[model samples]
Target: MRLRDLAELVRAPAALSVPGDTVAGAAAGGGPGRSTPGLAAASVCLYWGGMAANDWADREVDARERPRRPIPSGRVRPSHALLTAAGLTAAGVGLAALAGGRRALAVAVPLAGAVWAYDVRAKNTAAGPATMAACRGLDVLLGASGGRMRQAVPAALTVAAHTYTVTVLSRREVEGATPALPLTTLAGTVAVAAAAARKGPGALLAAWYAAGYGLAQARAAADPSPERLRAAVGAGITDLPTLQAALAARAGFPAYATAVALAAPLGRRLARKVSPT
Candidate 1:
C-alpha cells in the first residue's frame, strides 16, 4: 500500500491527539518522567491500530456509505488494514512493556483489548460510546503507570467524558443527527470544560476548547445536517489537545500543557490533508 493510503487508513493526523492523553496522565499522576515519551509513543501506536481496525471492521459498510475511504476505495486492502492493526497493537504493547514494565502492561493490555473489542463487537451496540470512552480513559492511566494511579483518575475521567461526547457525535457523521443529540453533546462539552478548568493557564485552554468545540456542536444543533455533524466530529477530534492541555495545566504543568496545546492547531492543519474523523 502507498504511504499516503496507509496514513489515511490509520487516520495518522488524528494520532496527534493521542500523545496528550499520556502527558495529561503523567502530569496528574505526579508529573512527567523519562517513561513519558515511550508511553506517549505507545498510545499513538494503539490509536493508529484502533483506527485501522475500525476501517477493517467497517469495510463492508464503508463500501456502501463511504466508498471513498481507503479500504472501500480499493486503495488499501482489508487484509493489509487488519495486519496493520495487529502489528501496531503488538508494537504498542511491546513499547509499553519496555517503558513501564508491568505497570504499563496492566493498562496497555486491556487498552488493546478494548480497542479490538470496540471494532469487532461493541461499536454498533448501545455500549459503543462507553466502550470507546473506556479505551481513552485507560490510555490516560497508562501514563500513570510509574506514578500515583489515584491522582490520575480525575484526568482520565475528564478525557473519557470528552471521548464519549465525540463518539456520540461521530455516530451521526454520515446520517444527520437530531438537534437533541448535538445539544446533549454540547452540555457534555461544557461539563468537560468545567472539569478540566482550574486557576491558571489550564482554564484558558479549557475555555478555548469549549469555545471551538462547542461552537461546532452548536452549529450542528442548529442545522443537524450530515455536513454539520461531520464538522462537529472533526472539531472534537482536533480540539482534544486543548482539553488535554487544560488537564495538564490543572495538574501544574504549564510548559507541558502549552506544548500539548500546540498540537491542536497542528492537528487541524493536518486534518485538512487527512481527515481526523
Candidate 2:
C-alpha cells in the first residue's frame, strides 16, 4: 500500500491521542517512570490494530457510507488491513510482555481480544459502546499490569467513562443528535473533570481539560446536527490525551502530564488533514 494509504488506514495522527492511556494508567498505578515508553507504545499499537480491524470488518458498510475510507475506496486491500491488524496486535502484546513480563500480558491479551471483538462483532449492537469502553479500560490496566491494578482503577474508570460518552455520540455522527445527549455527556465530562481534579496539582490540568472538552461538547449541545455532532466526536477523541495528562498529574508525575497534554494541540492540527474518528 502507498504511504498515505497506510497512514489513512491506521489513522496515524490519532495515535498521538492514545499513548497517554498507558502513561496515565502507569502513573495512577504508581508513577510510570521507565515503563511508560514501552506501555505507551503497546497501547498505540493496539489502538492502530483496532482501527485497521474496524475498517476490515466494516468494509462493506463503509463502501456505502464512507466511500473514501481506505478499504471502501480501494486504496487498501481487505487482506492487507487484516494482516496489519494481526501484526500490530502481536507486536503490542509482545511489547507489553517485554516491558512488564507476564503480568502485563494478563491485561494486554484481553485488551487485544476486546479490540478485535468490538470491531468484528459488537460495533452495531447495543453492546458496542460498553465493549469499546472496556477495551479502553483494559488499555489503562495494561499499563498497571506489573503494578497495583487497584491504584489505576480510578483513572481507568474515568477514561472508560469518557470513551463511553464518545462512543455513544459517535453512533449519531452521520444522523445528527438531540441536544439532550450532548448535554448529558457534558454533565459526565464535568464529573470526570472533578474526579481528575481531586488528585494533585494536576487539578489545574484537569480544569483546562474540562474547559476544552466542555466547550467542544457545548457546541454540539447548541446545534445537535450531524455536522456538529461529528465535530464534537472528533474533539472528544483528540482531547483524550489532556485527560490522561491530568490523571498522570494526579499521580504525581507533572512532567509526564505536561508531555501528554502538549500532544493535544498537535493532534488537533493533524486532524484537519486526517479525521481522528
Candidate 3:
C-alpha cells in the first residue's frame, strides 16, 4: 500500500487530537519531567494502533458498508492492518515502559488491552462506548505513571466522558440518530467545561472550547439526520484536543494547554483533507 493509504488507515490526522492526553495527565499529576513527551509519543502510537485495529476488525463489515476504506477497497491487505496494529501496540507499550518504567506499563498494558478489545471484541457490542472511554481514560493515567494518579483521575474522567459521548454518536454515523443522544451529550459538554473552567487563568479558553463543542452538538440535536450526526461525530473527534487543553489548563499548565488548543484548527484543516472519523 502507498503512504496515503497507510495514512488513511491509521487516521493520521486524528493523532493530533491524542498527545494532549499525556500533557493533561502529566500536568494534572503535578508536572512530570521528560517522561511526559515520551508518554505522549506512546499515546500517539497506541492511538494509531487502535485505528489500524479498528480497520482490520471491521474489514469484512466495511466491505459491505464502507467499501471505499483502505482494507475494503483492497488498497491494503487485512494481514498488513493486523500486523500494523500489533507492531504499533508493542511499540507503544515498550515506549511507555522505557519512559516511565513499570508504573507506566501498568496503565499502558490495560490501555493496549482496551484498544484491542474495543476493536476486536467489544466494538459492536453494547459495551463498546464504555470500553472505548476506558481506553482514553487509561491513556491519561499512563501520563501519570510517574506521579499521583488521584490528581489525574478527574482529568481522565473528563476526557473519558467526552469520549463516551463521541463513541455513542459514532455508532449512528451511517444510520442517523436520536436527538436525545446528542442533546444529552451536549449537556455533558456543559458540565465538563464548567468543571474545567474552574481550573485557572486559562479558564476562559476552556469555556471557549466548551462553547464551540456545544454549538456543534446543538446543531445535531436540532436536526438529527445522518449528515448532521456524521458532522457531530467528526466535530467530536476534532475538538478533542481542545478538551485536553482545558484539562491541562485546569491543572495549571496554561502554556501546555495553549499549545494543545492551537492544534485544534490544524486538526480541523487536516480533517478536511482526510476524515478524522
RMSD (CA, Å), each prediction = 0.6, 1.2, 1.2
User: What's the residue-level lDDT of 248 in candidate 3?
Assistant: 85
Report how far off residue 151 is in candidate 2 (Å).
0.9
lDDT tens per residue, model 3, 163-192: 998899889888887889899989888887
Q: What do the candidate models score in CA lDDT, each in turn?
A: 0.96, 0.89, 0.88
After best superposition, candidate 3 residue 52: deviation in angstroms?
A: 0.4
Best by lDDT: 1
TM-score of 1: 0.99
The residue pairs that clash in candidate 1, if any, are none
User: TM-score of each candidate?
Assistant: 0.99, 0.97, 0.97
Q: lDDT rank, highest first?
A: 1, 2, 3
- Which residue pairs in candidate 3 have backbone atoms (N, alpha carbon, C) closer than 3 angstroms, thus clashing? none
Q: Is candidate 1 or candidate 2 better by lDDT?
A: 1
Which structure is stronger by TM-score: 1 or 2? 1
Candidate 2: Cα lDDT at 4 = 85
What does candidate 2's lDDT look like per residue over 6-110, in tens digits? 888888888998888888888888877676689889989999999999999989989998899999898999999999999999999999888888889889999
Best by TM-score: 1
